[model samples]
Target chain A: MNLKTLRDYGRVIFYAAEMALRSNLTDSFVLFGILVQPIIIALLAFWMLGDRGGEYIIFVVIGSGMTGLWTSCLFISGNSITQERWTGTLELMVSTPTPVSVIVIGKILSNVLQSLASMVLSYTLAIVIFGYVPTINQPVLFTISLLLTILSYACFGLLISPVFVLNPDVQRLQNGLEFPVYVLCGFMFPIALLPGWTTPLSYILSPYWAARALHATSSQWNGLGEVALSWAAMVALSLIYLMLSSLLFKRLLRRARLDATLNIQ
Target chain B: MKAIEVRNLRRVFRATIGVVRRKIKEIVAVDDISFEVYDGELFGLLGPNGAGKTTTVKMLTTMLIPTSGEARVLGLDVVRSAEALRSRIGFVFGGERGLYWRLSGYDNLRYFASLYHVDPAVSRKRIPYLLDLVGLSDRGQEKVEGYSRGMKQRLHIARTLLHDPQVLFLDEPTIGLDPVGARELRQVVRNLQAEKKTILLTTHYMFEADALCQRIAVIDKGRIIALDTPEGLKTYVKDLAVIEFEVYGVPSNVLEQLRAQPYVHTVSVENRDQKQALLIHSPRGSQAVPDLLSMMNGIRIGNVIVREPTLEDAYVRLVGGEA
Candidate 1:
């Protein structure tokens, strides 16, 4: 698209994100996923991996935080379009000049941002409740990795929102789709512990790359080359997801409009 | 030039009914209907529930593609150029459901303005102007959930006008509102029309159609049975008149007998508080009233009155009392 069109989409994204954040402020279920769930996971991981020594504090914090992010992505960002349908605004959103995918990107951005709070909370828990210090070995690299992680997750969420809307049979399995990703991505543990056959699945998931980048930057300095490779994988996977999401969005709109299912809650 | 052109537009829904056997039923919601809405004209599609009014509006607004045939708004094809058409057209499906109930009315307008690509600068001024236009200026900060159905509907009107779209489609804009609220909404509609905006309004409320629409199309069973001006539609029953009589209980066979009588067009019974008001449409008018009493000699009758046929009478006749 042209610059002007891009600017307009950006404006929509900003407002839609703002709206999503505002509406989410009072949602107890969303709060639990973004805040409570991660803290609980962090607490459990802290005790389980405590024997690994104090150096692993940052690892526990990052791992538990990724769980919160994935949970929010799975429940909130994934259900963005479905939520609009429930509010009876799906048809209106579809009728607008702005593409629904842009609005959904805004929502995913908000969800990911909200999910970051879990990381901060886990860090606080390690320092205050557990009496441990968490540090990032490569602060600059970690920040860059965090930003890319957000982008990758946002793109992943983009792919997820349409899939849930277009195929409810897939959506029906949403509850079961969560822990598998957490396990495959090694949110609180390394994937080397899992069977070798599952390593391919972990490699394909952007989350696993994200966890690797964050864990490497936070606790151990995995060499710049390895970190760069993880970053590249996330970037490439994000682009692929973004392209696939656009296709899914087109299919979703056509199916919903043709089947007259846009308003079906 | 026509503001809206629909040529043999149709929409069919394939509904799966059975769980085990999986039977698919095809429902023709809009069946090969065609019409043109002229520039700056207020047109009404009057039909009862499930009469394809909404399906037609949805197609014109680019929310749904017609199963066959074509629809255009402002010279832009709805299907092939839906993206281009969306910015030029606005629509509101009436009810409380379409709004973001959690957001303040002002926030809702601002959000929709962004969706319509209204410049932030323009929206800053336009939002308050629209809130004032819909009489929600004072309540702009209050969440929509607190607003009455009328207030919510007024907000819907304000939301649709955000982009200053050239053509507007309102599907049942005042379906479940108090009489005062309904009147206020009608006034807003008139105001919109006076601004030279082309409007296509769909409602089952015949009186609302009669009071507002410059031209109307009576739709029933997925087809446009009649298209005419308000006065022109009234002429459908101009040759006929309504004969009314109040009775406690009218026998079903007697009502049937009245229908079989000569000069009697249609007989309809309306339940009043403690009595039934029987309305008979006939060309004979009062001339047929005397024969009606003879036929129900033993029935307790109250007051008898004869009146001119109304647009409602025309609708009842056109749709065969389905309204």
Candidate 2:
């Protein structure tokens, strides 16, 4: 990978998000939808887990935050390409020798940056307004969980990049990933609450492990001691999804015999 | 040195169905077309919509892999040395909406300039000159979104040239411009010609192709049916000279008589000032004009005009489609 190319992509992604904010989107709209949306969902978790709901708010906040990042990952990636199509700018991009990674990296970095900023803002509000900071035994261990959670979610975002290539219905497609992830993974509360086989199946999904690991981090349970073990599971899923997504992207790139220009009319 | 070379390129896209079904529907957009664009020639891939012109351009530019066959740009094998090939070339795809709308045209240029690895300081200096070249120097600070279509198109051209590439692939360079804007764009093409830049231009406008291209490949349905200079192709088809007349009070028999003339290929009867008119086609233009005008009698001929067949007529004949 060319470092310059990577830098170039990062610049593009940063510039794109900045451009988007000034013109098409509102500060409140992006903040409220991305940050506040999860908070609202967390309230539902509070209501459901009433009377002993401190742990549940943490679960809901983590889960909702995970979902928030999750939606934008694929959504932004897909929309960046589709928006390129929608706005008619993709052809100009494809014509240059700019590495394809620049596009993916640029898009993800922009979304990641936005999501991270939004994540911080949301957590701030939650701590002040909702009166919650995840309980932790060690700051160092909590930092590791935070890093891993981010890495895992980021990989999740990258893995879904190829769907944009096949056919981009960005908004609708983004909405599709939300409910299933929330229901199957105990993004809020516990997996035991999910009925039938979803409990077992949810364990296999990345977010389920992500929420579980975060919960363990907050509680200092036996599951927390297995934190080192958690890396292996998260890394395993990250590798699989990364490889699969890369292959899918390569295949689609080959098949996508599109000119640098899509027909405008 | 040949700047761009294509040999029997074939690209087939599989139009896939939904998730469960797997079937390959072959869309042979570019099918086995070959040509060598010599260094510094303004070569044109001239065609109408769905004529595979852009596909051929894409294959040469290394955007789409040719399913079979080969291409080399600036002596680099397109498939084998794609990165090197891509880095050396500049490209402008017509009707581009991919620019950052909020960024000033200057900023956009500078961004691409950065991608080319140009030094920031040099980019700052070079940008104004390029913007000036494209007639957007003063407006460079303004956001691209506010610029008119023609201004954006000019800026797009300026952006492609940011890296100082040896070859340029301009697909439909002047697609949707007003007549004056079209003239300005054609002038830009001519100026690029003066600089001796190797360019592959794809255009729907026949006149632009005729005026600017040193050689043109008339493509249709994924293949080049004819390749030559505009005049050379025109010569292949029989040149027709047409003359139109404004006349009045001519009898029905007189219109038939004009068509019966050995030199008059076609005649049309119409009343101009409550009079009769005849449109005649002949083998020769100026030579046939005088002879045809002298024959009209018993009816006043207001005015007579003669002209040679245009490139539009030549293209129609080349495509084997009657106009």
- Return the lDDT, model 1, position A108: 96
- Full-model lDDT for every candidate: 0.92, 0.70
Per-residue lDDT of model 1, residues A39-150, tens digit only: 8889888888876877699998998899999998998999999989988899999999899999999999999999999999999999999888887899999999999999
TM-score, chain B, model 1, is: 0.95
The number of the candidate with the highest TM-score is: 1
Docking model 1 quality class: high
Give the Å shift of residue B59 in candidate 1.
Answer: 0.5
Calculate DockQ per candidate and list them. 0.83, 0.43
TM-score for the first chain in candidate 2 comes to: 0.78
Candidate 1 structure quality by residue, lDDT tens digits, B164-268: 999999999999999999999999999999999999999998899999999999999899999999899989999999998999999989988988987888888
Q: Which residue pairs collide in model 2, if any?
A: A88-B97, A88-B98, A89-B97, A89-B98, A91-A260, B247-B276, B248-B275, B248-B276
lDDT for each residue of candidate 2 in B109-160, tens digit (9 for 90 to 100): 9767765656567888889999998999999999887998888889988988
